[model samples]
Target: MSTIFGIPTPALYGQILIGLINGSFYALLSLGLAVIFGLLRVINFAHGAQYMLGAFVAYLLLNYLGINYWLALIVAPLVVGAVAVVIERTMLSRLYGVDHLYGLLLTFGLALILEGAFRHWFGAAGQPYAAPSQLSGGVNLGFMFLPIYRGWVVVASLVICIGTWLLIEKTQLGAYLRAATENATLVQAFGVNVPLLLTLTYGLGAALAAFAGVLAAPIYQVSPLMGTNLIIVVFAVVVVGGMGSILGAIITGYVLGILEGLTKVFYPEASSIVIFVIMAIVLLVRPAGLFGREE
Candidate 1:
């Protein structure tokens, strides 16, 4: 019977939870984008397609191979990441050191092709992906009930995000990746395989996207258009956080998600555009983004 700011306690808490859940997805997706742009300087427009591909891979594993969610979680990203590797090696490699628009166009074309192909084969309707038995329930937290799977999503995303940040900021390989981006010729001179590093970086970005897709499969319907629905918002999050800023992407995603959720509670009509509005303001005020460095 209690309320906070005139809203019922349960309702307010529920929206906040929803926001956190949404933030999890945003963070995962934008993290991938940030990594790719930061290291490779490529604007990966095919990222959403890669995400959808991961979910579809999981779905196929479940239906055809009888694989469970846990196994698919490990397998889907590897498969999608491998595919990304191939794409980079065969096609994307040639386009480096050119205008970013070229990479964007190539990826955009790939996205269209991927979406079209999946739509043709699977139809536009969403398919259900049931949560595993281990995560098939909810727990009451006095003020609200939290789904076990949803809680798992937030935890998993946080772990992955933190792990990724540490890998890029703390590890030796990360140092090489940063070095390669800044000066590939110099890094290569030191016996590093710059080309291989670039390929792997792209694969890692795709793997991140795929991992997020696997997490999303049970929460949202597994549909070809699923990625299309969320990619724009994720891109907006990256922009607001600052392009190529690993820390910024992670933080901004959660913040924007919570803000969006609060907006839904306070003003339903404005909820959808709130993030974009903030993105526009950020762009005008600091084109480099809240966390991005002005170049």
Candidate 2:
């Protein structure tokens, strides 16, 4: 068996693959966060709950409605996104123009409520979610055995990340969104419904979180607390990437994931806190974040 630095080659590759898988989730979650904070200026503390909601929505659709994984993937995000829209319009919109802390507190409370309700109803145990049949198998990549679903996850996440980047950076609607954030009064005077745009942006952020949850369901058990496990790490990713930086969030997530994976291979004890350490360093060195513009 060939070894790299005394570590088995297969083990090394396996960890790297695992790292990529984790990075995919991080990218998706942070991307949503960046979108919300970047455009809406809302801290959106409830993002984790929204992710959990997505998994539950998928789970419920499958168990009750006989909807398959593929269908649930489409339906879950829509359902969660709609709920987010309603929340934004009826509740979040009121907090606009106030301190960002107020919005954070509000969403934090909502997250607690949602998490508590789900935990009360469905215990703390994780519920299993099966992968689609088409992606159930595995493939050999010479040195490692790769699960099709895992590969799909990485590919899908990359595509989604790139697509979102293009949407915000290249599209006309994206330009309007950027414009509205910069000068809502001007955009509104020019006939754009700024409020509507804000609502939609919040909804889109929630939808991205939901989509990530659906992808995560099969890998991690569907549980009320599942989102809690990942939310902090993702927040760190967003911070390190530069809060509200779309491209920065995307790049930082994957890089941090890979770094964490390598840490596990070398110094296992530091794996859990490595990302946080990096976040602290970034905060001290560049408070605006890696991609955030200096004010």
TM-score of each: 0.98, 0.98
Best of the candidates, lDDT? 1
lDDT scores for all predictions? 0.92, 0.91
Candidate 1 residue-wise lDDT, 1-295, digit = tens: 9988899988888898889989998999999999898877888989999999999999999999999999999999999999999999998988887988899899999999999999999999999999999999999987799999999999999999999999999999999988987888999999999899999999999999999999999999899998877898998998899975788899999999999999999999999999999999999999999998878
Residues 87-203 of candidate 2 have per-residue lDDT tens digits of 999999999979988998999999999999999999999999999999999999888999999999999999999999999999999999988878888999999988899999999
lDDT of 1: 0.92
Q: Give the CA lDDT, 0 to 100, for residue 14 in model 1.
A: 85
Count of clashes, each model: 0, 0
RMSD of each: 0.9, 1.0
- Candidate 1: count of backbone clashes, pairs at least 3 residues apart or interchain: 0
